[model samples]
Target chain A: MAERVLVKGTEAIGEAAIRAGCRLFFGYPITPQNELPEYMSKRMPEVGGTFLQTESEVATINMVYGAACTGTRVMTSTSSPGFSLMQEGISYMACAQLPAVLVNVVRGGPGLGDIQPSQGDYWQATKGGGHGDYKLIVLAPSTVQEAVDLTVLAFDLADKYRTPVVIIADGVIGQMMEPVTFPEFRNLNTLPKHDDWALTGANGREKHIVVSFDIDPHVLEKMNLEIVEKLRKIEANEKRWEEYKLEDAEIVITAFGTVGRIAKSVVEQARKEGIKAGLFRPITLWPFPYERLEEISKGKKLILDVEMNMGQMLEDVKLAVKDHARIEFYGRMGGVVPTPDEIFEALKKFLNV
Target chain B: MLMGQILSLAGMFEGKHVTWMPSYGPEMRGGTANCTVVVSDEEVASPVTSQAEVIVAMNIPSLLKFEKAVTPGGYLFINQSVVDREPTRIDINIVKVPCNDIADALGNLKVANMVMLGAVVEKTKVVSLDSIFMALEKKLTGGKASLIEVNKEAIKKGMEAAK
Candidate 1:
């Protein structure tokens, strides 16, 4: 049986990471997520784990890279501006195929915009915040409970795919308190073995090197192709989403993260008003869940895309619908949240309820 | 209903849709702030309550900031001891009560929110007291078990005052 307790989002992430067998954490304190490192600092030593409050995000990401290379489960976290600083390291981790978990409790930004919650980084996360042909399996959690749940899932997926995973939550979800149940930490022996590719001194087998290099043009192309194939498989197998009232929805709202939660409440309220509004929330953002959206939009009157950013994910919605359904967008920028009333008004216009 | 964000869960007003869209701005740092909770029987698309039907301002700043945002025929419940304001809007009903003073009498300052919540419920009767109590219990459990009694008492006081 699970016991419920009020948990802050940042602390939940730290606790979940520890329970997931993550032994190393390197992070910098940034607003909206300061509690994560602080929690880790107070708790990691007690569990015989290493928690380092690094000098900067750049240093922190590199520390994650080093720890991950040593075959240790490791993680780090930051907000928007700090996330920007860590991009180069993230890109390197992606290219090197390093499996690590990265948490971005996103705050407003475009250049130190503010320390408030914002989803403006949608494109940055989905389109590879760092660079190159890479993708960070982004999970946008709408609540403190999901924040913990997603952090645990992030480590598992990161290890399985040998890629960095990002848990993108806004300040609202990061700082809020909610009752949540954490699964008991499992024995390390039950987890999948990573000895196949993890660097463990080769253990008298053979010499091993951890690098993202291939001087030969054909070899590099082959490596790139292999990565693409893996991503394609992930897209095919890991597209998880939640559908509410979509089977007969006239106006469907596509949202992720906090906006999705507000959209959900609006759907219920709209239903009482006799408008068939539904919510389609993506659990795995990187995979995009386009196919399911395409299937749901077959007979819908309109698809409303709600986000915290101005219009980052709006493009994806339009692309998925492809003129098959009338599409519109609603959003807030710089950490301002979209209210259910505002969303309801928008839905009424589209559905004519 | 189980999207699991503590602030977005079921409210005291059963059959009413209520959501809290938290301000990610300066108010988040213990500064005076407000959230829009819409208690609607019909479906609501937008959750932002720019102009509230009723507002309970616990501090001077909350009063100053939200005074203009009340609907033309809405009500503004103020703790007279905490906020002193000349009635400027004739269309809106303004009820001034010494809520902070009552909370002081109740032996806790934090019950101010519960008191205001009670007054809002009694004046508007939008949400049921039992439901609010349930939500409050969920919200204030764990390290806060000691204050629940005082908060429950404060809510009772506000309900009686409103009646």
Candidate 2:
């Protein structure tokens, strides 16, 4: 049974990772996401797990790579800048097909922006910021409980696909406290079946090799094709979103993560004023559920894309809706979140309501 | 922050959806140190709220900053020991409770958050006083339970002084 408790997003993700059988965590401390590593540092030892704080984000992601290759469920947490440092490692892990869960509790960016929340990393997360041709199963959670649930889900998805999964959240989800019930504790004995590829010491069998590099161009192309196929399978099977009051709505608001939650409030406000406004919140940011959005846009009057950055997800929304519907945008940057009232006012002006 | 937890816990105790967003900066007091606790029947979308139905100001600056945000017919709980002036808004209901004085009289000034919490609960009935105590019992960890009695007294004084 899931026990309900008031939880901060960072703490919830940490505890959920532990419950999800994450036995190894290697992460450096960074603002907005420090609680995650701190929680792991305290709790991992209690559960006979390993929690290591490396010297830098580079070291941390590399450590996660090593631990995960050994068939251990490993994770790391960081903010925008720290995540940037780990991007190369992320790409390497993707090519290596290592299953590890990573979290970027996004803060203001471009530089060492403030510790406050911002969704500016949307493009980085969804568009494969690392390098090469690979994708991370990106999940954006709006609520603390969803953070816990998605953190657990991230591990399952990573292990199933033999790829990395990123729980992309913002500072609001990291810093805020809300009542959360964690998913049921998963036993460590029921861990993912990675024995065939895992680099456990060769006992009674041939030594296992976990390598990302291949000299033969055609062989490397085959490996790349395999990873691309996995992404396609994930995309087809794991598209998740939530639709609110879309049945008779004239206008729809599309958003994800923190801005998504605020946009829901705007939808509610618009409805209260007798406007037919609906909300479409994407739970799985990548494997971007464009098909459902296309179906929803069929007869809609307008689709407003509300995001934290000036407009990162705006391009994707436009691509989804195309000329099927007129797409508009409203966003705030640099850790300054747009309020529900502000968003509603913008909606009113945009729709002339 | 303590009061934020208490009220949110009380809301959860009442089966309401509760979310608290706290601000942390360099300065502790007299700075723009405040938090937003959204208690609603529906699933809350955003934790940040520009307008509040209630304002619980523990100090002068909080009152000065949050007073205008209160809705026309909402509630305002002011810690009179710290705030020397009346609210400028005429539309909202104001409950003046000297939380600092109440907690000091009960022997622990730190429980001022609890006192203000009690007044907010009493004035708005946002949660039961029993729920507040229950939340405190679970929260006031080892060695801290010893002070629960004084905090309870402070809450009672807050309830009485709110009107």
Candidate 3:
């Protein structure tokens, strides 16, 4: 039966993780995402789960590293600044090929930006937030419901690939209240077997030292090549994006995360006004659906890149369309949202219809 | 605000294509606070509702802030005690109920949400009382059982008062 209740987005992530069988959560409090750890504290105990509000973002990421090493489904959340502080651990986790979920409930800025929603992290998330040659699976969910669903899928995908996964959202999606449903527990299950690559004492086997250090340049290149090959396999298997009204579209808008949701509304309103504008929302930011975008933009004249920052994703759109379409950009920076009417206006300017 | 509340509320829909535009910040604490929940059977690319077809104005700020966003032929429900603003929009249907009074009479201020829920139930009829009750039971328990009963009473009183 269909049910409706109002809930904030951060709490939804915590609840979904618990239902997805995540047993451990370690996070430091940051604006917008603080609700996630707060929710975990109240409910994780009920499920006999572990929820710890660590001293710092660094400690939290290390905690995630520890739990993930034990093969436990674990997660941590932080805003942009804290996420930046966590980049080192995230890089280490990526190098170790740990299965864990990290949520970046993004806020404004290149540094200590205000606690307002912003998508400036687009490049950081998709281009590997940390150094070295590694990629983390990134999922962008625009609504409270998707926050729940995506967090669940993040764990599954992380385990399936044995790589870290990121739930990249903005403060707007994190703070909003919407109706969401938890699927029946039967459909979700956490794996009980992860000791092969994990560090559960090596179980009387050779001591497993998980590190990214090999003193040989040739070995480093081989490791990088192996990681690239794995990423290619993931791209082929998991690239996902949603298309709306593209078959007959004259102008297509590409957006992700919170801005994508607003762009969707603008597309619908534009259509009502007899404009042939469509929406392409990327659910998976990394392993981007470039092929699908290329195929869909075949007959389009213009592709509008909409984001919360100053056109970070526009570069990707240009690369995908390969100049087949004239690309335009519209963005609101420092946590401002482009409303449907604003997006519609942009569409009119782009298509001139 | 609670985990169960966030989970059960998010569970009502089944899709990634919904918009959840929430107007929240430090400015919301002192004044009235509200959010937009857009549930489309089809894919929703953006989820910001400036005006609401139905305004569950728990306080006056919610009513004044969102009442103008209502579509021409929409409905507005305000809790009489908390909302002191006069109705300015003549096109939308206005349903006023003493929800706070009802919740107060029921002996709990927290039940105000339930009272608003009852008012929403009557106007939108989006979900049945039994289902909402089930959600409540699933959301609240143990020491919270008393709260559930009070909230249920508030719902009943608001529904009857609306009638």
Candidate 4:
């Protein structure tokens, strides 16, 4: 087994990206996620990578688009408001089929609400904040170790599907510290070649053009249809979730990211008190584990949906269960995290035990 | 924040699951800067807890703010040098240690946090002192390397005072 090291979440993500052979990064500074770019700025040079602190988030996302067009592993990270600024570029990336990793260490916000952690951007990330009929593969990680693992996976998925991927983490995951074991560093020389589509001077062959715009409506519709096909395949293959103590669970809890892990404690406490409770945590918010959730929720007495926002993910939970089970929502908005005790209390009240 | 980080590293060295989360933003800027560290045999779930098994209150405001947060029969290490009043909680075990005074005796008041850490470790036995020394060596590197000896001495004094 690899030796474990104590590291902050943001730094762990940066290190994981480097180990995954990502050599280019472009980002703007934002609260909560500032450590990520700061870590990249220091580590990128050491690893012979480029880390550019762009003038703004708009500039940052465009830079990512440009770098990604070269078929290089590239990424940008920001907080909620800055993430909002990158929407137009993200839409363009989605349309152009560019491979890039975008991280949003989300904070409390409709607009710069606070620098504390929040999950208010769930709809924006999984449901496409950017304009257009498109989708970005969204991965939400609960722990620092998972954050590292998913960062590497994000690069792979982005390259595999030739589409942008978003790592939707909260401020708590961005700032927290945990022990993590990193994967072996990838050799840049052995990375998959992308010379087929990459614009590498064309050299006696046809010149490749990458653009999101087209004049004809019919042609654009065809392009949109192709994207839809790709999204369907991704949705079929990429849905990921975790089930804990679900075999005999009378009550099921659905949560993601930071709230998901916290709900695990509630499940443990509930079981200790003779309540048959379980936790179903969605790891992929975009390709939501709707089918598995529907399958597991059967015969469960109550389904509790917990989050750090005003019940954003509850909508998806409702969609998954779909009248099959009783669903309840417990949420705290504007960066207030719900504790395990309160969640257990809520669970006991619902169970009346 | 530093003490919380050290405890996390020590826990890791001891082959336990650990997480360290500090209060950020306004709470860290001249306010009662506090952190939560959870070390467990099983995978840790929440990084933040409403009730904690142990809490080291470094100042009066921190003590007053987190007094009720400690679980019943849990350890609450109070920095008695600065905090003039006694805690109101009766269920929790309170170990009042003069962290600042001990660090002052060790000729470096900045090691006050380390002193409090020693007291906590001595009382709770969460992590070994050797693991703490190892963590300190890793954390206090480069320009801060020279102060490790004084910090270790402060931790020893804190352990003795707790006894």
TM-score of chain B of 2: 0.92
lDDT tens per residue, model 4, A1-353: 99899998989999999999998989888888989999999999998999999999999999998888888899899999998999999999999999999999999978769999999999999888999999899999999999999999999999889999999998789889999999999999987668888767789999988889899999999989989999999999989888989998999999999999999999888888888889999999999999999998887899999999888889899899998999998898888889999988887787777
DockQ of candidates 1 onward, in order? 0.24, 0.76, 0.37, 0.87
Please give the ranking of all candidate structures by DockQ, highest first, separated by commas.
4, 2, 3, 1
Give TM-scores for every candidate, taking all chains together and pairing residue i with residue i. Answer: 0.83, 0.97, 0.84, 0.98
Clashing pairs in 2: none
Best of the candidates, DockQ: 4
lDDT by residue (tens digit), candidate 3, A77-182: 9899999999999898888778899999989897777888899988888888788889889999977788889988998899888789999998888887666777
Question: For residues B1-163, what per-residue lDDT tens digits would candidate 1 score against the true structure?
Answer: 1112222333412544444444444565677666655556654434455678887677788788888988999999887767776657789988776788778888887666666666767787666667666666676678986767787788888877767
Ranking by lDDT: 4, 2, 3, 1
Two-way TM-score contest, 1 vs 3, winner: 3
The predicted structure with the larger DockQ, 1 or 2, is 2
The local lDDT score (0 to 100) that residue B134 gets in candidate 1 is: 68
CA lDDT for candidate 1: 0.78
Q: How many pairs of residues collide in model 2? A: 0
For residues A127-209, what per-residue lDDT tens digits would candidate 1 score against the true structure?
98887788889998877777888888998998888889999988777766555779788577776666766677768677667
Estimate how well candidate 1 is docked, as a DockQ score: 0.24
